[model samples]
Target: MTVPTPQAPRHVRAVAVQPHWSARDFTTPDAFRRWMRAQLEMARPHLRPGGVNLVVLTELNGLPLVLRGGGWALRLRTFERVALALFLARLPRALPVLLRERVSPIRALQLADIDANTELYLRTCRELARESGVYLCCGSAPMPRYARQGTVLRRAPGVLTNQTVLLDPQGNLIGVTDKVHLTPDEEAGGVDLTPGDLNELRVFPTPAGDLGVAISLDAFRADVIGSLAAQGCTVLLQPDANGAPWTSQEGLPPDPARVRDQPVAWLESSWQVTAQRQIPYAVNPMVVGNLLDLTFDGQSAITGPAEQAPSLRSYVLTDPRPGFLALAPWVTEGTPDELRQAGLDRAAHSGHPLENEYREDTLHADLTLPPATRPAPPRTPHEDALDALLRGEARAPRPGTWRAALPALPLLALPLLALALLRRRP
Candidate 1:
């Protein structure tokens, strides 16, 4: 027996947004909702009334909403210090959850305010999707897995995971996917995230196509990307937040022969994987600017398989360039030579004054993917092993398998080396 292939509509207007990520003092939930609404309003020009429109926001863009009630600390220099302060300020409330759950202070801090933060996050997404009449891929956040438990939105009793949510025009959650691969800092540093189950990757049925999501690091994994494509996902949405200088070189370089810029390293996970897998369309929206000390910098872009004809014309980078459907304008907009001559490149990488080399922009492309020319390959045993590993049912992987290769892959390195020692504020 065979299953029918999932089909996409002939045309879709995809919008990828590059949002400036700065800490806002959200003293009230309405303040938080208004800020989110303003970000989506930037894409209002791209939305067509009766057409298939989908807007994608960057990963962890929703994370700062956790700062809802953060007063003067919102103006501080680093998130680690602010988070520590918040945890300590609310310790009396957080201690109970911490002791009950046997989790870290950071986890308990989140759990303490999970109900309010989760509600604001979901409500903002629902309202925007319903009002704009567009499918919305709300940016990722560190929150517990939530489900509707007979009229109440309840969270699962587990450590928080980074999750991306999809909402339809009617304000219904069409799909939800968690980050399967986490950055080093997320695993060991203060974040203390739980890696998501590989088998739970969801594919959403939209007018645009059967959409699949690979949150930031997960986009780089063959097992994750291949699994989604095999399940008939034609459009790949990668919500990302690269908390490092976009111009700086870090991690295992994309090319072993020589060092390349950060964006080049990103290509391996974005268009490179989609092109190789024959996935028709891919959209990556990245957050930029600084949230306290942690910074995010990247040019949000949308592209198709390299073999396919270019459907969108704008390009962000000229060096190590790939065909892009739509690319957002950069904060320091120009070629490497132009930037160097202007001395903006040095300013971008400087450690002195806080850098403002980030932009807020929305990119749109009217894409019509060519019909699939070949069948998507089936899921492999290695992928099955990944699923089992997430389920705690797999034996230790042998030499030269996925486990062996993990250490070398570029995992969207988030450099948090500058975190200051946590000191209590008098």
Candidate 2:
């Protein structure tokens, strides 16, 4: 048998997709097929670059399978339990039968979920890689099951983990990386998820430079972006799900604006962060809801350190950057100091109380507020009222008193005035 040569290094282009919600709502296999077909249609154009890889994200249990002529490939099956199910129920029993019948490798078999049989699935994937001549990457949630065994609670601390594996052309395991940052809630729950050490950033070590893959949506964080850039990560693969839009204009919902400053602060600090959404709905949609949106909403772009910024090279099909290139954009033409001064000037012109007046002759410096001195205690309402009374000003009666005494007080006043008038006449 002629040995297969390694695939040539090609430009990597990735698109992040959030499959329509209808795909997950249905239980029937036919509905699933139709949805999968539609998704493939949406994704096909983006996959044209020769070395392009698609990062498809979905929930732990919601992976989709793509059928070839003779066999099938499981797409984005991240959950090991799902892998186990496929192996026991389908592959192990069917493969031998297909070989005996002399069926084409692509046409004679079907792909299904195999939960609890990770090793078998890995072996099968390696075999497919050797035969099919296409690289396959399955993105999944980094659940705690892979870290240790037995009865893991989803809510329990130390249950969430992030990991990804790459299969070579001959189906050999190339590299794997555990995710660095855990979701805040996951951290609060005491999940053992911590940032991956710099040494572990090796998921994409092909001839194409380090192609570090970020499972779920960890690529959105500023620290993660900076860490990946620092480690020379050229491409970042992000698998994400469709989520509710971050901003709600109607008063009916919580406003993303209230917490927008936190991410803005993060982006301002770290410049290189590129993310592509992947398939499988498991962690994608839920994580998107938790963190702010990863897609740039065209509102504002971040300007920061050039070395740490995303590649200034635009995404062109013809001139793509090598292996997992940084997604953050650098401000090569503009300096950060200039940007800072411009921001300060904008703030001053926008009526900021602390901003110094602009002077034509000289640069204006930021004005500092004087240290506040404590004022004497304020007088009580009662004390103020007594003081007013002592000063000969008429004290305002309590609210109800005017109504209660109106008739009696007016009658007495009129009679007393009449007596005074008669005395004066005499």
Candidate 3:
């Protein structure tokens, strides 16, 4: 009798696709499809046959589709021109919707193109998922509520949302999740978006595990991830697009005594989740490159449960942390000093053709999902300390005495002091 060899159990093999956005890729529906297909193709090689393969993309990856058919204006290389072109082209139909919905012309223009954009976005995702035979998170895009009428998708009367969709290998929609937390920029100005309800957060079950999609900023919120984990979500997908320098400060950072880099603060997100929620697996894909005046950059990473050997592709990090399985290579090639000299921290765009910002890449990791009935990992000391600190702060009494005003006396007297000095000088 011949001895039979036993095969290892199938597990989740995921890829965080780091795509560099370019206006040219979204010039037309065909172009957009090609770009999306290319991204999936890059990740396809890493997937194992007959296993769960998941592809994660960043937030706003599809928002550029709003500029479809503005190929003539792309050469101008300004979002203003593209928006003007699209606005003029859709004015006839958009004007009526703007009047009816009482929305800003900026938003109305996006709405006018919603149906086509949504249809193309859905079709491209479906085709890619089916062709690649992998589960796909189609990233987040600004979209209005829509109804499917047979083969067509029709826009309904609703506010636009930053929404993401997950699809199965068979090209079926598995789940949809909208960003519940909006950045200040997203909530203010013309982009005023509707936030998703926390109560209705969706968790989709898969062979890998129960998966939760938390788009960008939503992933940082404890309540959001906690709700998903409570509902048996074992894996978290955080699609991000930080529209600023990755090395810049995240709005003054968390410490007033010292400075903190934005990307380092961002690392706290996925790492914090695995430590807190006991959701052992998480993927964060970031969209890089520039579009008009806006620039997006970040290092894409796949985080696992515990410490592992870091990949060579990790952003020559200043502070290396555990739990990161893999990280996409940095967009610019240089040492910290060389990069700083190259204006890596500045807003100026480097026109170098060979820069990694113009290229698309993928970071892959093979993760074994915990069993369905697995218990939550024990809390770490760091988490316990944090919890205790939060409790102590909550119980601390707020100062109501005149001593509270002492700290602000100098600030309050600054204007008066300046006025007296100016008067005396005159």
* lDDT over C-alpha atoms for residue 272 of model 2: 29
**lDDT tens digits, residues 1-426, model 1?**
899877643678889888775577254687777767887898888887688898998887666765778766765556667787677676555655655566666666677776667656777788888888888998888767544333334445546888887778777666567899998767735566789999978566667667889999888888898888877787899999887767665655465567656766777776776557556788899877766666577778888755443554433343434457677766565666564333233233355454555678898877775444444234333233322332334333111223443354344421211122142111
lDDT winner: 3
RMSD in order of candidates? 10.9, 31.5, 15.2
Q: Give the TM-score of candidate 3.
A: 0.78
User: Model 3, range 257-346, lDDT digits (tens) per residue?
Assistant: 575657667866776787554577898998887777566777888887665435422344455656778777665666665654333533
Clashing pairs in 1: 78-293
Per-model TM-score, in order, reads 0.78, 0.37, 0.78
Q: Per-residue error at 55 for model 2, in Å?
A: 4.7
lDDT of 2 at 84: 29
Question: Against the unseen true structure, what C-alpha lDDT does each candidate score?
Answer: 0.68, 0.32, 0.69
